[model samples]
Target: MSNLEIRDLHVTVETEAGTKEILKGVDLTINSGETHAIMGPNGSGKSTLAYSIAGHPKYTITQGSVTLDGEDILGLTVDERARAGLFLAMQYPVEVPGVSVSNFLRTAKTAIDGQAPKLRTWARDVNTAMERVDMDPEMANRSLNEGFSGGEKKRHEIVQLELLNPKFAILDETDSGLDIDALRIVSDGVNRYSAQGDRGVLLITHYTRILRYIKPDHVHVFVAGRVAEQGGAELAERLEAEGYDRYVKAARAGV
Candidate 1:
């Protein structure tokens, strides 16, 4: 079984004002066959935690260590991290004007596997993944996310997750902008990935709706850049009922 561990993670970013810290001494751990949900209000650093662990250059890790199965990952490059079995499904997937979805997926798969996928098997696999996400097969021929709807983009992200089959997947607001149908589709894809029984998932979201479809093993309430509270699935039920008001007030009052 594999594990992803974050310890005392402090991250910062340069804004117009100056270097502003985003994640304040945050810590989290995700193990194989487990899913963890991070819930909080806006600006509580939920996405920051996801991007920080993915080795985004925009965010700097001032203090902390992120390790995958005892190997230090903070020192790896973004692509290196992907090759190391980490996958990130962005909240807003960027458009690649010239790259077709087919090419992009094959290229990414090759990068992570160190060899190109066999053309026959690769084509069949891509089709299967797209079908699982309810995405049209023709989309594989279009430029990646260039003219797709938000639901399509999110669905494409899931396709990648299935094809790559990473050890750990960090999904940042995947449920955003999704309608009921799209949400269920995306959630099912995520569920299929986690159902592999050896994959870990870190799902970050402001709402618990997605949790209804994909239940998490643990739930964390993030406030003021730290995990103010954490518990089982019941914690998510509480957040859905009480909201983050208590946590927000406590954080502001320095409680």
Candidate 2:
């Protein structure tokens, strides 16, 4: 079984003012078939952790180790990390002006798999993935994320997730900007992907609504860049009712 482990991860970024530490220290392990939800207030370093794991150059890992199946991932480049079965669905997917969605997906798949998928099967697979996310067939011809709605961008991310079939998926606020129907469709797509029984998912979000559809095996409450509390699904329900006020207060008071 595959495992993704983060040990005492500390990260920082260079802002206009100066360098600022984001992640203080974080330790978590996700085994295959497990879904872990990280719920936190804004600026709690949730997205920083996701970007760090995905090898974003802007976030400097001052200390800690991230490993996938016992292999050190910190040393790998972004593309290399992708090849190692790590995927990140950004909150704001950027637009690639000239790259058609179809070409981008196929190229990414080829790079990760070290081979070009057979043309016919690949085309069929692409169409199937798009349909699963409720995307129009015509979207395949559009430049990636260019002139797309926020919901469309999020849906496209899921399409990539389904096609790439990564071992671990880090979805940073994937539920953002999705309407009720779109949320259900996107959640369904995520559920289908997670049902494979051999993949791990790190779902980071601010609200508990998505949890109603995509049940997490463990729910971690992130406070001040660290996990202050963790429990089963019941914890999420409590957070939904009580909110993060208690945790935020405790963190501010140096708890």
Candidate 3:
């Protein structure tokens, strides 16, 4: 039973106007096989938490600790963190001009596993994962995310998620910019990954539409850079019906 634990995590970033704090003492624990949904308004530090956990250098951790299975992850580099079984699906996946999708995926898998996968089996796995995400087979030859549509990029992220099979995954706004069909496909891919019964997922989003397909084991309402309320799936339904107005008001009042 692996666990990702965040204890009083406070993160900040340097901007043109000095440093600005984002996460304000967040504490959460996600054990293997649990899916946690973080819903919040804009600028509420949702992505910051994801990036921080992924070891992005831009975000500075001023206080608190992040641990994976009792091992301190805050001190690990981004690649080291990935090797430790942490994955982050960015909202905007960047383009790699020269790296073919096939090469990139295989290379990442080899690095993580500390061994090169058998050529024939790795090719078969890559093709199977692409088909699972409804991605074109030709995409394997194209440079990663270069000239790809938003929906395609998102699908490609899921492709990586399926093939790499990380211990924990943090998806930041995965449902954004996806059409109905694309959303369903992406959600299905996520569902398949979570079905493994030993992977933890942190799904961050503003809308509850995705929740309809990917039911969260726990829903946390993020407000003012902190979790204001947390409950079961019913909390997500209420947020869908009532919106974040009440949470926003309460956050503003410092309640």
Best by lDDT: 1
What are the candidates' C-alpha RMSDs?
0.6, 0.7, 0.7
> What's the C-alpha lDDT at position 43 in model 2?
92
> Model 3 misses residue 76 by how many Å?
0.2
For candidate 3, give the lDDT.
0.95
Tens digit of lDDT per residue, candidate 1, span 174-231?
A: 9999999999999999999999899999999999999999999999999999999999
Q: Once superposed on the true structure, which residue ranges of model 3 sit more than 4 Å away at CA?
A: none
Instruction: Write down the RMSD of candidate 1 (Cα, Å).
Output: 0.6
TM-score for candidate 2, residues paired by index: 0.99
| lDDT string, candidate 3, 174-240, tens digits | 9999999999999999999999999999999999999999999999999888998999999999998
Point out the higher-scoring one by lDDT: 1 or 3. 1
- lDDT to native, each model: 0.96, 0.95, 0.95
TM-score each candidate: 0.99, 0.99, 0.99
- TM-score, structure 1 vs. true: 0.99
lDDT of 3 at 50: 96
